[model samples]
Target: MLRNMLTRDELIQWMRTELPRLLQEDPAFRAQVIGILSEALVSKGELTRLLDELRAMREESQRRFEAADRRFEAIVEELRAMRADFERRFEEVDRRFEAADRRFEAIVEEMRAMRADFERRFEEVDRRFEAVDRRFEAADRRFEAIVEELRTLRSDFEQWVRFSQQEFAALRVRVAEMGIGLGSLGLRMGQGLEEVIRQVIESFSGAGPLKAARLVLIDEAGELYQPGARVEIDALVTDGRRFLVEVKNYAKTDEVWAFHRKARFAEAKLGETFEKVLIAPAATASAVALAKQLGIICYTFRAAESRETSE
Candidate 1:
C-alpha cells in the first residue's frame, strides 16, 4: 500500500493540473474547496469586505482606461488634421514652383529670340564695317597714287623752270649784242654821228653834274681846231669846265693817244684844266689800258665795262 501511494512532488503536480479543471467543471467541488480556503484564511465578514474593495478598484481602473482611450482618440484626430494641413501647404508650394518655372521658361524663350536677333544685327554691322574698311583702303591707294603724281610733276616743273631761266638769260645777252650791232649798222649807214653826238651832249648837260652855262664848240672857234692842230678834237666848254669829247665805232690805242694830245693842246690855249672823254661802242684792251694809264676815263661796252663804268 505504501508503494502505491503518491509522492509529494506527484501530489503537487496533480493539484496544479486538476485544481483549475475542477474549479471550471465541478461546481460542488469548487464550492467546497472555496469554503475551506475562505474559512482557513479569513472570516466571512472579512472576505465580504475584501470582495467589495476589489470590485470598487476594478470599476475605477475600468473608468481610467476608458478615459485614456478617449484621450488617445483625440490625439489621433489632431495628428490627422496636422497631416492634412501639411499636405495642403506642400501642394501650394508645388503650384508656386510650377508658376515660377513657367515664368523662367518664358524669359528664356524671349532671351533666345533676342540673342538670335542680336547676332544677326551684329553680323550685318560687321559686314558694313568690312565694306567701309575696303573703301578706305582703296581711297588710301588712290591718295598715294595722287601724291606720287604730284611729286613727279613737281620735279618736272622744277627742271622746266631751270631750263627757262637759262634760256631767258641767254636771250637777254643776245638782245644786248643785237642792240650794239644795230648802233654799228646806223654808223655804217652814214647817218651823221655828229648830230647824234650833239643830241647826246645836250642831253648829258641836262643830267651831268655840271650844268652848261654855255656850250663853246672848240671845233668851231677855239684854238684847239686851228689849222695844223694835229688832231680833230670834238670839244665843249661849259661853265668853265672844259671837256674834250669824241665818238667812234671802234677806237684803237693810237686814236686814244690822239685825243689825249688834243686835250693837252686845248689846255695850253684856254689856260684851264681840261677833262678828256672818249665814247666808243668798242675798244681794244690795249686802248683801254693806255687810257687808264693816261688818267683818261673811258666808257665802252666790253668786259672792262665794270672797271670803268660803275654808274
Candidate 2:
C-alpha cells in the first residue's frame, strides 16, 4: 500500500536516500550496476578513472568543510573581543556620570551660600531706609515748629501796627482842639478891636446912633432863614442913614465876599437900604479890591493914621 501511494518525485527522493546505503551494503546490486556499465562498453580504465574522480571530489568537499569551520571559529573570537571593549567603555561612562553628579552638588551648595548673603544685604538696606524715614520725620517736626513761630511773629506785628494807627489818630484830634482854642482867643481880641473902632467912629462923627454903640445880631432868635442860622453886625445904625459893618483882624477876599452876602441877606429881610462897611487892622490888597467891587467901604488901621476908602 505504501509503494502504491508514492508519487514519481517521492520515489526518486526515496531512491536517492537509500541508493548510497544499498551500494555500500548490497554487493549484488552493485555488481549488477557494474555489469550494466560493462554492457554499455565501460572499460577497466574508465572505471579506474571514475573511481579516482569520485575520490578526488570527496577530498575537495572535506577541505571546504574544514575552511568553513575555521571561519566560524574566527567570527566567534571577534564577537568576544567586541563584547570586552563595550564593557570597558561602559565602565568609563559610569565614572563620568558620577563626576558630573559631584559637580552638580557643589554648584547647589554655592547657590545656597549666595542666597544667604543676598538675604543679609536686603535686611541691612531695609534698616537704612527705616533710619532715613526717622530723620525725615524729625525734619518735618522742626519745619512745623518754625511755621508756628512765623505765625506768632506776624500776629504780633499786626497788633503793633494797629496800636500805632490809634495813637496817631488821637494825636491828630488833640492838635485840632488846640487850634480851635487859639482861634477862639483870636476872635475875642478881634471883637474888642471892633468895639474900639465903633467908639472911634462915634467920636469922629459927633454922634446919635454911633454914641449908642449899636452892635446887634441880624437874627437873634435864629428864626430868620433857618434855625441856628444867624449873622452878626459889629456896628449897625437903623434909625437914619443906616450902616451895616463887619470887623476882622485881617480882612481876606473870602471875608469881604461873605460880608457882602450877609448885607444882601439882611437887606432882603429888613427891606431897607444900608451902607455896607468892612473894618480891619490889616487887610489884603485883594480884599480891598473885592470890597470896592461890591460897593462897600473898607477901613484899615495903621500905627500912624487910619487907612480908609470913603468911596
Q: Clashes in model 2: which pairs?
A: none
Candidate 2 residues lying further than 4 Å off, grouped into runs, are 1-195, 203-227, 302-311
- The residue-by-residue lDDT of candidate 1 on 113-168, one tens digit each, is 99999999999999999999999999999999999999999999999999999998
| Each prediction's whole-model lDDT (CA) | 0.71, 0.72
Using all chains and alpha carbons, the TM-scores for the candidates as numbered come to 0.32, 0.31
Candidate achieving the largest TM-score: 1
Model 2 lDDT tens row, 1-311: 86799998999999999988998899999999778878987698998999899999999988998898888889888888888988888888889989988998999999999999999998999999999999999999999999999999999998999998899877754543343334335556663433444554453345545522434445655544465555766666444556787767677788887888778877877788888777666677878878899998876542223444544
lDDT of 2 at 192: 41
Model 1 clash pairs are none
Top lDDT: which candidate number?
2
